[model samples]
Target: MDRIKEKMNQLRLEAEEASTKVEELQAKVKNLELENLTKEQEITSLSHKNSLLEAEVEKLEETVKTLKESAAEGQAHGTQNETLNRRLQLLEEEAEQADKTLRETNEKLRQTDIKAGHFERKVSALEAERDQWETKYEDMAKKYAAVQKELEEFQMEIGNI
Candidate 1:
């Protein structure tokens, strides 16, 4: 009986440890989800920026095309000037800036992907741990019930004596 009680106590302590692990896992899950949400938002924001950059690139390409046509017309008319040269220089600078922005956005997207992968792995590990704890708890509960039943039977025998 004393051994059964000791087992019960041991089971209780193990249960407490399991409970603590569950709470910790829950907290980690919540935090990870929040971080995932933040990363998603960042990805969304970067996508918007990418769209805007694409639009700007289209606009710049159209401008460059128009400038080329204008330059051809100006050469035919003997009307060339420094102003057209300056406009071409500005357009080149804008194109370079757009390319740099695209590269940076791609880098940020890659980093978000890495973080999401890490979070997924952690969640999977926690789920496995939780399952293990559930199995152990059930096993302990069954053992405890069987011990209680045996103790009751012994008490009844004593009473009849």
Candidate 2:
């Protein structure tokens, strides 16, 4: 009976040791499950952040493309403005030349008018001299007629003597 009791006590100790080991294994399994759940949640959060970053990168690419197009348009506009400025300068120079030609024509017209007035005065003086010469010729013809009549009377008196 003493030996049976000792054996029974030893079996009880063995059973308690087995129970503690089972409990420890159960706790370790629960810790492992919790760690897996935390890793899953972190993976999901990181995936969402990566997607957001991809969208931001796409937006930046589009903005860069738009800026490049605008720069090209600005360069074209600058070229057109330069061409227009050159054409306008040429037109201004042509206008200046035309103005100078008009001034020269007006000066020539003024000189022509002065010459016309001088010619008119000379014509008037010539007409007055022509009238004086015609009157002198008429007086000389009357004196010659009187002297011829006196010579005819003297010839008739000499024939009677």
lDDT (Cα, 0-100) at 140 in candidate 2: 66
CA lDDT of each candidate?
0.93, 0.86
The residue pairs that clash in candidate 2, if any, are: none
- Candidate 1 clashes: the total is 0
Summarize candidate 1's per-residue lDDT along 13-115 as a digit string, tens digits: 9999999999999999999999999999999999999999999999999999999999899886664456667778999999999999999999999999999
Taking every candidate in turn, the Cα RMSD to the unseen true structure, in Å, is: 68.5, 6.7
Model 2 segments more than 4 A misplaced:
1-25, 116-161
Best by TM-score: 2
- The segments of candidate 1 whose C-alpha lies over 4 angstroms from its true place after superposition are 79-161
Clash pairs for candidate 1: none
RMSD of 1: 68.5
lDDT of 2 at 102: 90
Per-model TM-score versus the true fold: 0.47, 0.56
- Each prediction's number of clashing residue pairs: 0, 0
